[model samples]
Target: MLKVIFLAAFAVGTVLADGELIILNNPGSVHFEGSQATNQSFLKEVFTVVLGYTPKLTQPWDGVEIRDPFLLPEALVSIVIEGVESVKSPRGKHFPLNVDEVEEVTWQAVSRRLEERDTNNTLVRIRVGDGLDALGQSALGELKPNSVDPASLKHLSLNNEEDQKFIEELQLLRAIAQKIPSTVTANSKPDVYWFVVSGLRPVMDLHGKDSEATKEALKLLNDAVNDLSNAFTDIYNGQVVVALFTNDANKLRNTRSVESPRVRREEKAGELETFDAAAQNSSDNLNTIEKSIQKLATDTEGLVEQIVDALETTTQDSEKSTTESDLEERKDDIDSMHSSENDYDPGKPITLRLSKRYSANYPVIFNIFLWFGIVFFFSLLAICIAIAGMDPGRDSIIYRMTSNRMKKDN
Candidate 1:
């Protein structure tokens, strides 16, 4: 009997299990180092365009630090260059090429000249005036002279501090770009690569401020940035990308949606309310069964007492036998009810589980759509109100009174 009760209790107890989905937004870090004024201006403009709000510029790199770090996706833009001075290299003798005379010079021609003039590779250095640092080096190695490529051969300018810094910066950019996968699977999106170069006044000033040379240099720089942007787009299959330059920091704010990418919640919160209701129902059923069992036990005890009294009071043999028989039958029924085989099965364990629920704020897209819908509705309502008030053909009381007054004046 005891074993049967224990088995039933175990069967009634339940365990419930649940699962959750976690979403992580990618992590991004921006490093901006340069003139305080220029840096602050650029930072404000970029964050405003990206985040839709201008971040307070308390620290030099305040806005660069990511706000939420838990399971941060990955850095979208790893490097930012703002008004940093270019590196300086030792000055060697300059080799002049008349731009008007030579239509194009190839890498082979320049390399041959360098080899012949300075066999030791000492005192002869080359800096491609254009922003083709990587391409120039590769061409020098692989291309032969007489290729007649306009971009291949140009007069190497004397390296300045700013020029050297620019070269190193390009090197860093290339290295970082190389690490990005050339291709991504359809199911996955590639990480972002963002590079912003602003306020190149000093570099531009290296040439006369308004000179043709300065214009050419600026054009080359723009072309390089475009080339890099296209290359990354092709490699990443056009996952989010922002590569732009601006002379005016203020103009940077005009670019829209530069803000950080967001993570969308893919799953709804767990069904905890349903689980709680089920657990409560099971508890109530268990309590009811327990009370019934206690009542049955008390009733069985009373029946046994009545049978014993009948046996003691009746001296007749037949009456005593009948009472004893009735008592035995009642006891057997109670025993059958308490038997494990008849009352409870121990093979199945009851399980009831309640899980915690989690929820994320609404997605940005949903919020945008919701607000746009609301605004459109309100604007439509306003338009209808205005038309109703101004419509002269309408038979409203105000319009009718106005018409009568106008007729009277006429």
Candidate 2:
């Protein structure tokens, strides 16, 4: 499920964010080499899309060869070493070879940043337990690739150490997820990472990958993913994209042993014939690998389309959710504004009118003015009546004048 989601997102070029890629490449043989269950073609196509180039084949297929996706500047690539010819590059990367201090080296690779390094190169980390190597080829052969409870492990009493190592590796992955990126270069490519948890391939395959041990391992992985997803919930999709897929579904041929040359003539001839037969088998294996690569290249386009569709669907869903959330918020605001206090009715017109509640008691100034006018009117009326009733008094000018006139007439 994660493989589908992650591969889909990875194929989409529009959502490239400045994030880091963590690859866990578990080595496993291809179960149905050309069946629909195989993931190699899809993987190759995904890598080609992300990396901007396909892995170049330096030489023909050797039993033991690895290809770096980014083509790091310094890595051992030889034509032939001890009868082993370089395998045709499957347009893929190789697993780490050095077993000594593998943990330290693996962590170093994981933690190394762009600013810390002088050149701008892609980082690939390989991890195999040092203790796993200490068990040597004999014990390693006895135990499964990543099994902690192999019969031999029980006999050797190494269950605890193996379990501890697996736990530590899980811890390491969690740490890598939690760490802040100290160095990010100015690159246009998206930070599509792969975290290859090697060693489990011995127990896993294309169709037969669901073993109890594998399930346990995957459960732990799921836990780690959930933890990280919760931690960065806000930016899980937009910023820190997380997806998982099986890196490959095909298996390389098992390493072949070349016997020493015989001294007897008949033995030597028999040995030559055996070598020829082995060479033919080797040729057939090479053809299988080459055809697989071609198929991968051809089928990549289909995978890309499917992944793109998936990404589009995811995008549409996210956008739809945001829109719904926005509408919900707006509705809430409107509901609050048209509250019970207003006695609002949805069918009523929104027009408004002035309130009739403006009537109130007169102010002190209005009362004082009215009283003064009434009192002045009454006093004037009384004065007029008093003057008329009284005979013309000498104190008044009009009365004095009228008295003088009357006397003259007498």
Candidate 3:
């Protein structure tokens, strides 16, 4: 009777295996100098839960496989596999993944409870994850969503002695990526999943673009690129990509053939050196552009304050303030300032936050300037009058002009 009960329970457990699980890890195009063990460990942990099986550790660069064989010792009996492939997509034509063709794959158990599903019945979906390091995650969490404060950028510029715009951009990219769903479900089915990782970094330089600042930007960008590349080495299952661009002639010259090209470019002589030169020039240009952008941002902020005050003042003016047409125009101006709102999207190429929440502040400096100018002008006029009164020739003219005798003499 005890043996019969044991057999019945074993049969029940096998029947209860209701769903299939898959875990995948793919390497991106660019390889990092260091980063192997961490990625393997991450993959092992992810698969251990997803697939009810222990992984056979091997070199990630070569390839590893797990099988769903029935003869294997039934110690939880789940299979896990890892593969590398080149994923082709029309959307990201110039993406690093598109160029490198390195991807990882695995299969895991859906959950501890369900086991009926198998690899044949389930559609496997795969994607990359935009892995954020501790610093990256911390930085992103601190930033406001869809809230690109121009003031914040100015503050960053002033505080960051290194002038690390690339780092700032990286933070921005993380915020943008976070808005999108992390996992992709195959055919809208819950059983299958794909995870993705998109890397963000700085592009190189161009021809005739040699300067110290550009060189520094290039160095900073390269450092980020290298750091990110190394970070991905440990995340074995998700696709990894390095984001590089050639938006301008100079950028093209710098990155033409250096590595992954995110932008279209024409081949030039000494592309590597051209890129190096462009990277150097980019620093100076960036400083100039940053200053200009800061000034514009400040002016816009001031304008916003003035508009808000005007609106409040008119609101209080009950009957004697601005007209309906003028108020409407003011509203229109405010709306126009955020015209970029009409073009916000997650998948769009240019992700710029043109519409942002603004605050109103007292115009202390402006008011002080106005009051001081008025008072100084009046004081100067009084001094001139006093000087004229003390002058004998000028005093006679003024005194006689007001006198009854002076009128008779005239």
> Quick one: best lDDT, which candidate?
1
lDDT tens digits by residue: candidate 1, 1-410? 99798445433321110110011111232222221122323332333323223233444432234443232321122122233222111111111111111111222332343344335431112232333454344312321112123343142132565544444444433433443344222123223333434324555657555656445444545444444444555553443223231222222333222421211121212356667888889889877776776777677668767856776676466544455666678667756765533354333588779686544434556789999999999999999898777756657656776786778988
Please provide, for model 3 over 218-320, each residue's C-alpha lDDT reduced to its tens digit, 9 standing for 90 to 100.
4433443334333332322233222222112222334445744433333444687799898878777767766766676677768877887777787777686
After best superposition, candidate 2 residue 159: deviation in angstroms?
A: 5.5
Candidate 3 accuracy as TM-score: 0.19
lDDT of 1 at 372: 100
Model 2 over residues 47-112: C-alpha lDDT tens digits? 332233333333222222224334321210011001111111222332212111222222343224
Q: Which prediction has more favorable lDDT, 2 or 3?
A: 2
- For every model shown, what is its TM-score relative to the native structure? 0.26, 0.27, 0.19
Backbone clashes, each candidate: 20, 25, 46
Summing lDDT over every window of 10 consecutive residues in candidate 2, give the lowest-scoring window: 76-85
Ranking by TM-score: 2, 1, 3
Each model's C-alpha lDDT? 0.39, 0.38, 0.37
Better of 1 and 3 by lDDT: 1
Q: How many angstroms is residue 215 displaced in model 1 relative to the true structure, after the best TM-score fit?
A: 2.9
Off by over 4 Å in 2: 1-42, 51-159, 181-192, 199-214, 225-251, 255-410
- Candidate 1 structure, TM-score to reference: 0.26
Report the C-alpha displacement of residue 102, candidate 2, in angstroms.
Answer: 18
